[model samples]
Target: MGNITKRGSRELEGDGAPSLVEGPRTELHTELYAAIMREDCTAIQVLLSSHPINQPVTILANSTSHRFLSTQTQSIMPIHLAAKYCKAQSLLCLLEHGADPEIRDSRGLTTLHLMLLHWPISSTMWTKLGNRTQRTLTNTQKDAVRCLLILCEHGAHVNARVDDSNKYSPLHLAVAHGTSPVLSILAQKGAQVNATNESSMTPLHMAAELLNQEMTEMLIACGANVNCAVSCTGSTALKLAVCTASSKAGRLLAAGVSCIHSLLTHGATVNAQDHEGQTAIHEACFGGREAIINLLLEYEANVNILTRNGESPIYMYLQHSSNLRDRVLLTKLLYCSYPLRLTNNQGALPAGIMLPEFHLLRETLIKLSQKLLSLEDICKRVISNIYGEKHKHHLKQLLPVKMWNSIYCHDSAYLLK
Candidate 1:
């Protein structure tokens, strides 16, 4: 391998050398990079026909050739740039003209790596120009899959991970971006579906963390371990999904799909605990994900499951509730039968943890605790267990249609009623 040489600046020596980057072939390589960046396919074809196809092009964002010398300079091959910019025609033409598919850029990213990281800029670009429809977004995804197929056909390492920074395989990247098409492509091309990143997080863990139902399902179908945990924290994919979805700031879009439901459907342990001994239910409680909490409860999740720190799901719910008037959620916990008498590491009861303004909540729980369990209530609880537990497919066979609907279809808002 020829070293890129640079001169004059001591900083340049640490980054690039005088003899290589500033060499006589600089202008030709620069022009090639510009052509690829601009998606100039005609110029790319003409240039490749006249010179070496694997020529290294260094894009100097400023005066310096060494990337480390300045924030601007980046060393990339023609194919890597073409793949990143999603210049499908330019990418294919360069590949047809003999561009090496396996060339690593400054970040140790291959053309295949670029394809995995491909993003849709149509939303941003079209917003300024016009309006990009959903079809435009989908086409961007299809283009990425096409590029990946080309690289895989050229014998690109289908399971190659990012060499610099965190070791993220193409599968991990595909999961992180929630790109179902690339995921399918990678899996079909023999990519390791169970591949983990530097954190020992599998693609399922990543999909779970993003609350990406489609990707989570795909990875599971591809045989990704549903209960795969982070090596350091013992955090399962289900826990990660709950935590990620619950922690979102805006109107929780995560409530739309229950990753908890997906993982459990695939045989994930309902009470699987993380490094902190916190289950997915604990995470859902902490995030105030009422729908998820209900789903977990329906699966017979242990309501009193505690974290390593002695915090129960109820404790987490009370501690995390930003508004006490989030009463339906609070009451759902009560209805699910998490003990109000239970205390946390700080020795606070569920009521003791509440603010003064939440006296009504505290009073309601205390009053409910004193009420004798009636035969009707006992039967309803038993019926709920039979109708709503993990074997949901058996509901129609086990119960009358009206009873099943009454028990399963009702939301938390109907819990007190």
Candidate 2:
């Protein structure tokens, strides 16, 4: 007992937590890991009291499961395991017993990374969509925050990339998991707001992809570049928001709209194109959400712009039969005045792909396409294309209030009237 006491006291004599030292992957390390997985704090204390604290505990990396999912890997320390499983008491016990928070697993994820990875979600609120158990997330969130503070206080690198391959910082993890409080804490502690992941995507891109307005605004306030392009697709945050909005449930439409508005108000280019020459309007049309399409148009998104594949917004709208019932959106696109006879890469005309049920819509578009343009329609198209980039102050003076409000409000009815 005396020898064990002396060893325990001696292990804590360093300036901080002990550094990881290479050692045998013995059964003793396995027993220690089993104790951690079981959250057996007493056994953990005994294991540390009996053996050296810095000996390596080898766990296999499971990177092949999925690119987005992280698995426990070799080089993981006891503190990382405890944090990952949300065993706060065991984690505290390990920390007090000299486990280092700065130690990284084989993938270079720190204790901080593991904490964010396993942070609790509000099962009662947002869990209906998943299999998360119904439990109050209040205590779980508090515990997560406590662990985060402990790691930071013990010199965990907040901005450290999780792995050399992905370059995902702790902030990126927080954003990906939708942990807002942890995100704020990381931002307050100087996590790089514009730090890019392997795809050259900033945290703002993730927030926009999730269509989370609150997270998007927070990242913007933290100075995340609203218009940063992903190197792989050359997609900006605004373009990502539109693409993401198309796939979400209809109940989340308002949140998607709010996110788009936030990106636009932050000076995101409404007409910004991706590598394929598709704008946010193109994504909105493809998504088939009437509200988002209206919102993008209200922001003066150019509807007539063609993709590299030669698909215009009108062509994109007609390509998706799901959008057939959205008469207002169809009307808006028909009025945008692009030549409908142009062929896409598939050689499909804007009018060629119409379903049988959309006969009335097809008739209306044909009549409008053939009718001579009114003086007002000609002025509207010219203003939309020519003065699209002019400052609002000049446009406010140049155009009549009704016409200006119709364009700015995306009121297709008023504009068409």
Candidate 3:
């Protein structure tokens, strides 16, 4: 400590505390701040031994950054600043010198929260968006992980939550922004995998919403509830995954698919209905995702599942008919008893999806809707439903291979074309 001008000429008071006779109340902690920043453990111990702990000080934030002149200074605890900047040695010193790791700053974020907020995210989070950035855990990230472990070791509450409106737990922040090492540290330290934020969104839900397969799998392995629904929409992790998949393509689309598979394999309800009575299959169909539709169907997703307006999955599928160049797929869905004659709350029928140029297609659909199902098709529907009722998601595993092939691999293209 180079005798910071404000801390000059410290004299011993009657109580033996360092009576600073020269500093403003606002800048009294300048020397202590310099000591912490310099990672001077001896000086830190000396200052903390005499001065009051948890002193709130105002200092310019982000002042050294090239982007701005200087940000408005806000009062923050020194422990938070240490953790936020990933001052690993300084943070350990602070905690060892009696700093409360669980104490919240003005933003209601604890030391663990700020540590996670500053940790570097890996490429795994952006691989879904087609970013192929090479992932090399930098020295800074290692320091962040070490800081997290130190905080945890020093009795930082792993489950402590932010007091703000988001009500984010340390685990939520970890999953939202932190790397795997940080998340692992928090999880091993007893962070709650199923903890929900103010939106009733769990860590797994946030992972699914971002279509982060790695985080999704990690949360599942930690015993995350695969079916936790959002408070406002009753949207489960599966539904949210379907929605994300519908909007993305290429690598991102595959990432969403992987996340959905992880959730479903971990026992997510394939047929979970939302507040509007929309299931995952309905969303898949509405998005015109052929692969997604097939996956949902194989998991025994109900093709005839209805929405609040009485619209079925096939109806949603037809809503994007331009994408369905293969009319045979429609015929196959009809064979699966997609309820071609069902009407919605507005009296919209399956044929309503047909365009004027598609006259032959419309006529074909109306005639098909009027005709009774052939015995083979009816048997396919009846037997499949019966088997699904008994086997549920395990239908493929339990059913005989030949029988499963016979039911799912019918040659309907020739009939439609």
Model 1: residue 40 alpha-carbon error in angstroms: 8.7
By summed lDDT, which 10 consecutive residues of candidate 1 come out lowest? 61-70
Model 1 Cα displacement at 241 (Å)?
2.0
| Model number with the top TM-score | 3
Q: Best candidate, lDDT-wise?
A: 2
Off by over 4 Å in 3: 1-28, 49-51, 60-75, 122-137, 324-328, 350-355, 358-360, 382-409, 414-417
lDDT of 3 by residue, 159-240 (tens): 9989999999887887777355666667788988898899989988888888888888888888788988888999999999
Q: Assess candidate 2 and give its lDDT.
A: 0.73
Report, for every candidate in turn, its global Cα lDDT versus the true structure: 0.71, 0.73, 0.73
What local lDDT does model 2 show for residue 113?
87
Question: Residue 237 CA error for candidate 3 (Å)?
Answer: 1.0
Residue-pair clashes per candidate: 6, 0, 0
